[model samples]
Target: MQWIPDWGQARIESMVANRPDWCISRQRTWGVPMSLFVHKETQELHPRTLELMEEVAKRVEVDGIQAWWDLDSRDILGADADSYEKVPDTLDVWFDSGSTHSSVVDVRPEFAGHAADMYLEGSDQHRGWFMSSPDDLYRDEGQSALPPGTDPRLYRLMARAARCPSLSATPFLRRT
Candidate 1:
């Protein structure tokens, strides 16, 4: 990924190295559910977690996210239902935006299997989407999502333009 001012990548690297692990689940009553079953006693994912996720995905495709909330654990788990429970937490908002390459881009007919050529955003996202996307991609795909030598552009608002309101109509300034 390209950072226009060039230091953007370094800043993100430092943040990732120093930051604690991010939790990708939330307790919200609404949202895309994590959609997996876990062993009730061990608190570990069911051995068939992936298979269960696939079943949920099919239902979600046909019935939307409600499919997950409405699911009856017994229907899928049968006798195993006694030992496992569905994960109630929904995926954090970061999971949605951070995993767009897989959830959105990879599903498209034209963009499937291709990495994004560019990711353009304001400086504020450097700590949010900017860092989350690559981190998520690396975990999911085990490789860099952007091709080598792509433009590294980072555009930031000047101090007055970002914080101080002014009547002047001067264009926002940025460094090359």
Candidate 2:
């Protein structure tokens, strides 16, 4: 929510225009399920949905999202199965992009202990990857590599010394 840009808000008249729809349906079968059930007749979420979602999330945590795909409506909705339909949609592209840092840095070790030194891209990156990467970084950790309240001078010196093997010895002579 904090990611919304003031400039974009000023340009758009309605809230709907500013945010993308959460629709997850897709023609392909290679991602997380939308995790929603709709009324077969009304094509909307079934009543007592929040309870159902919590149950589904528990299963997802234990067995992964694929479990949702394998689940039967009767198991998830019980008596409502006759009236409701499962939505076959999955996650949005941005969700995957945004979660990379969490999945990579926090949950996975491929990017752990590594700091993103620079992000180079076209201007659109400000609204796309660049924006999402920082958000993901902060979500995993309260602050970034150079978080506030840390000494900038010391940080830079340490970073420089870390990269230079010869810095193991004192670089400058100290006059006693």
Candidate 3:
């Protein structure tokens, strides 16, 4: 493929060696907001954070993504909630796209909790979605971060706006 470079394996190896912890926070309104409460002074997640996160996730599963938006901090954190501030930021685009392995593929009983046969996205995803998805998959499922499918397809983007005449440009352009 014209897109595949001769030194691709070397680049991949370097990325593996130098990659940093994925920061999944994004300052946007289009995704599932990270359901976290931070201490106003300590600047840390609430001590009971995991319990609160589970509650928020349950609400999301039952009432849709907006459940977090509708919830008052006190509703989940109780009276002491006033001491903490709910993070208004949404999840990073990478985390949002990377989760499809679970949300789309594994959720169906027919899929046997495995990855899909193919994943097609823009070239920009090599670092964003491609990287984020597996990181999230392994974290959540304890399986190798790599999905069973091949590396996602990538195309040359036009400089004007990074448009991929073949796919929606938002996933590529937004991240760039």
Local accuracy of candidate 2 as per-residue lDDT tens digits, 53-108: 88998999999978898999999778888888888777766556645544545554
Error of 2 at 35 (Å): 0.5
Worst 10-residue stretch by lDDT in candidate 1? 167-176
Can you tell me which runs of candidate 2 are displaced by over 4 Å? 1-25, 99-124, 127-176
Which number leads on TM-score?
A: 1
Tens-place lDDT per residue, model 3, 1-176, is 22344354455456767998877788887787888899988989899988999999999999999999999988888887878999999988777776765775445566554444334444555677766654655665586644554343334444644453565532221110
Measured on C-alpha atoms, candidate 2 has an lDDT of: 0.56
Q: What is the TM-score of each candidate against the true structure?
A: 0.80, 0.50, 0.68
Residue-by-residue lDDT tens digits, candidate 1, 63-130: 99898988999988899999998889998876677676666554666655556545555667666766
Better model by TM-score, 1 or 2?
1
lDDT of each: 0.72, 0.56, 0.66
Candidates' RMSD to native: 6.4, 11.9, 6.2
Report the Cα lDDT for residue 62, model 2: 100
Better of 1 and 3 by lDDT: 1
Residue 85, candidate 1: how far off, in angstroms?
Answer: 1.1
Q: Runs in model 3 with CA error above 4 Å? A: 1-7, 18-21, 140-176
Question: Which of the two candidates, 1 or 3, achieves a greater TM-score against the reference?
Answer: 1
